[model samples]
Target: MLQDTTSSAPLRSLLFHLSDVELLTRSARQIVEEEAPPCYTLLIFTNGTGRLYIDNQPFLFSPDHCYLLSPGTSLQIENGTDTVVCFYRITFTVIQARDQQQVLYTEDIFPNRYELRVYPLSRLIRLTEQLYAGRLGKGDMEWFKQHLHFQELIGFLLEHNLHSDPSLSLTQSVENTIHYLNHNFMDSITVKQLVQLANVPHWQYTSIFQELTGKKPLDYLTELRINRSKEWLAISNAPLRDIAHRVGFADEYYFNRRFRQTTGVTPRQYAISMRQRVLVKDWTGHEVHIPLQPLRIIYYGETIGDLVTLGIHPIGGNIPNPENRLYKDPTTIIHDVGFPFNTERASALEPDLIIFANSDERQYEQISKIAPTITYNSWATLEERMHILGDWFGKKREAEQWLVHHHNKTKTMWQQLQSSINAGETASVFTYDHGERLFVMGVTGFSTALYHPLGFRPVSKIQDILDAGQGYKEIQESSLPQYAGDRIFMLLPENKISRRAAEDMMNSTLWQSLPAVQSGHVYMAEEAKWNFGDAFTRDKLLEMLPELLQGF
Candidate 1:
C-alpha cells in the first residue's frame, strides 16, 4: 500500500471513500465485537487497557494503539476492568481508479495489519474530529469533502505512526524485565540488573517498575522468592535453609525476617498454621485449607452483592459496572481486583484468602499461589451460597438470621402482590443487546428471581432451558411469542441499537398480538439495574416488586 502511494500517484489516483465513523464506549466487563464488512476498519482506542483480538490474533490495547483491520477480519475488544474504554471506529472502502466499475478492491491492502501508535495523539484526534463532523452530512459535495478529509486523516496516521514514543520504548524494556524476573526469580538477581534491563536511570526505573508491579524491583523479586518458598514449605519436607537457598536467598536468617515481615508470622509459625487450617472442599471439588477467621480477603465473582449484603466487605474485589444499583453502595470499600482476576494485583494486596468464583482450573492454578484460593459457585441459589459462606466464615448464625429475615420480608411483599397476580400466570424476560441481538432469559439474571417458588412460573420452554443449564438463549424476532409467557419483561439495554430493536419489536404486529402485551401485563425494566439475582438484588426487589407491579 505504501509502495502504491510513494510511486508517484496523484490525488484522484488513490482515492479511498469514507463510509462511516462511529464512536463507542464499553463499560467494565463489556465486550464489543463484530464480523467485518466489505471495508477496511480503523479502530482508534482513545484510552484504557483492553484485550483486543482480530480473528484470534491477540494484542494488548492501551491508550496509544490503533488497529487497522482488513475487510472480513473479525474484531473483538474486551474491557476487563472498571475503566471504561472509549474508541472510534472508522469504516471505509478502498477504491482503485483503474478497476472495473471502480468498486471496492477485494485484495487485502498493505498495512491492513496496522497496530500502530501516533505520538501526540491530538494531531490524529483533530483530523478524526473533522471526519466525524461530516458524518451527518449527505449529498455528492459532502461525499467529496469527506473523501478528501479521510485522505488527510489517513495521511496523518501514516506520518505520525512512523515515530514511536520514547516512553513506550522504555516501558517495553520494563515489561521485558518483569517477564524475565517472573521466570528467573530462583536465580540470584539484583535491582541493578533489572534496572539495567529497563535501560533507564535508577529512580526512573524504580518508578516504572513500581507503577507496573506495585512493588520496587527488589521487593517484587523478594515476593516471588517468598511465594515460591511458601509452596515448597506446604508440600515438601524441606529444611528452612535449603528452601531459602533454592528460592535465591543467600542467608536463611534474612529469608526468615522477610517472610515474617511479609506474612506477619515467622516461617515456623506459617508452616504450623498451614497444618492447622480448616480444610474444606470448594465448589469445583478442590480441597483447600483456609485460615481461621481469615481477613484481608480478595473476592472475584459476580455475586459480590451477596458479600455486601452479609456485611462482609473484602479487602479487594471488582465492582463491576457502576450502573448496577445493588452493588453501587457508597460505603463499599473493596479495591478493584479486576475482572478475569488480576493475580499479580491480588498478590500485591497480600490477601490471606482468595474467593475465586469461576470453575476454570487453569486460572485457579495461577491464583492459588497468591493465597489459599477457593473456587465458588456464583450461580448457586442465595440460601445455599449463604450457608456455604457461613460455614467458611463461621457466621452460621448471621447467615441463618439474614435468610430468615429475607424470607419473611419476601413473603410479606408476595402477599401484597397476591391480590394482583393471577393464579398459574407465567413470566418471561427478553433483552436486546450486542448490537440488536435478542435473547431470552433462562437460568440467569432476574430469571432467577422470577422463577422462585413464590414468584411467577416459568414458561415450559424456559424451564427446559433452565434444566439444560443455559443462562440465556438467542432467538430470532419471529420466535418471541413461542418463548414469551403471560407476563412479559422487556429488559431495556443501554445501547441505542438494542433500544431501537426493542422499540421495533414492541411496534410489531406479533408483539401487539401477544397475550401479555394485549392484557397490559407487559413490563419494562432497566437491564443494568434489574438484571441480576444476587442477595442484594433480591433484597432490593423486595422494595422494587411492589412498585413495578403497582397497577398489575
Candidate 2:
C-alpha cells in the first residue's frame, strides 16, 4: 500500500501499479503556465477559485467546486482572485495496444454538472497513501487484483458523472415523503391529507408514486403503525391501549388484530418473546436466568440515564420513575465520570459489562479492564451509532432485519400516498427549538438515515449546503429566502427561552418574507418525540408527511 507522507492521519494506499504520483499546492502568485500530463489527476479546491481551459473550453473551479482531469485533454490554468489550488497527480501504465498507443483506463467522459463525486476521490486518496508506504509487491496475481480495482474506480466515476439519471429527482421526492411520514406518524393522518400536503393532484401523484415505490398509501400507513407498535411493545411497558392510540390506531382491539395479522403474534406475546431473547440462557438447558441474577451491566459518563431509559423500559425492566433515580441511585452507578479521559470510578464498578454513553477513549480503556466495554463515538451519525450498539449487544442480525421490515413498510405507505396526489410536488420537515433556531433537518447528520431512506430531496440550496459539508449548521437569517420550497416543516423550540428566541426569529422581517411562510405551507412540529433520531423519531417523520404535503 502507498502512503501520503504529507498528511498527518494514516491513509491506506492504492493497490494499483502507479509509475508516478505528485501532490501540489499553488497560490495565486504562482504562474499557471503548465498543462497536466495525459494521466489521472484529482484537483481539490479548499479555499480558492480558478479557471481551466480544457480542450479549449474555459471552465471554473472554486473552494465550492472540484474536478477530475482525464488523459489526452489539452489544459491551461488561470488563477482567480486570492485563489489556491491543491491537486494530486498519478501516472500509471495500462496494457499496451497492438498499434503501440498507450491504453487509457476508461472511455467514460466527465459530466458537466457541479455535483463532484467525492467517493472516488476519497478512495483515491486512501490508495495513494497505501502506495506511498512501499507496500505494493511485484507478483502476477497482485498486479491482476490492482488492475481490477483500477477498472472499478474508473467505472464508478463514469456511472456517477457521465451517465446521468433523471429518475433520481423523483426518487428523492418519494424519499423525502417517507422521511416526513416516519418522523410524524404519531399524529392522525391519511392519504387525502398527504395529497393536500404535497400540493399535487391526486391521480398523477398516485401513478408515479406507485410506479417508483410499489405500494398503496393506506397499506404503507398500516405497516408503519404496526412496526411502531412493535417497537413500543419491545421497549415500553406502556399499556397496549395507550400505545395503539399514540400510533393512530383508534381502537385497541383493531390495533391488536392488525398487529397480530402483520407480525403473526399478539403484542404481549411479541414483547415477552423479545424479553426472553435478551435474558441470559444456561448452556445445557433452555432455562432462563432469574430476575435477581439478571445480567449486571454498569453505565458510565453523561447520558447513562438516557440509555437506561431507552434500554430497560423496552426490555421489561421496571423501576418506577427511573428519572428520579438519578438522584436516589448510588453515586457509583450514575456519577459524572467525565468523558474521553476519566476511568477510575468506571473501572471500580467491577461489572460484567460496561457502556460508556459518551465518546471517551481513555474511559473506554479503563472500563475494558473491569469487563467487556462498548464506547459510543459521538462524531458518527445516529444510524452509525445504532449499528454500533447492535453489534455490541450481539443483535446486529435482528437489528438489520427490523430496519428492513420498517423500510418496506414505509416504502409501501409512501407509494400509496403518492398514488393519491400529483407528481413533482415537494415537502419539508419543520421543528422549533428553545433558541428559536427554526432548525430544518436535511439529508445528513442526525436526519440522514431517516431522510435518505424515505427518498426526500432537500430543497435545492439546502441540498447544496449539505453537499458542501454544511449539514447541521445554523441557517442564516438572510439566507432564508433560498430555502423557500413547495413544503415547509416548522419545528418549535421546547424550552421557554428557546421558544421565545424562535418566535423572535420567525417574526424577523427576513423570515416572514419567505414564500413558504406567506403561502401557509409551514406545519409546526411540536411533539417531543419528533425532536431526536431513534425508532420513535423515524415514526414521527413518516406520520407528519401526509399532513405537511397535503394539497399539491
Point to the candidate with the largest TM-score. Answer: 1
Candidate 2 — which residues are off by over 4 angstroms?
1-352, 357-372, 377-387, 419-455, 464-471, 547-552
Q: Model 2, range 4-53, lDDT digits (tens) per residue? A: 11221111222224555444556554547567566655454433335566
Across 235-326, the per-residue lDDT of candidate 1 in tens digits comes to 44678999999899998999999999999998878776664568989999999888775656788887777777777777687755443434
Error of 2 at 268 (Å): 31
Distance from true location, Cα of 529 in model 1, Å: 1.6
How many residue-pair clashes does candidate 2 contain?
Answer: 80
In Å, residue 20's CA in model 2 sits off its true spot by 74
Instruction: Report model 2's TM-score to 2 decimal places.
Output: 0.36
CA shift at 462, candidate 1, in angstroms?
A: 1.0
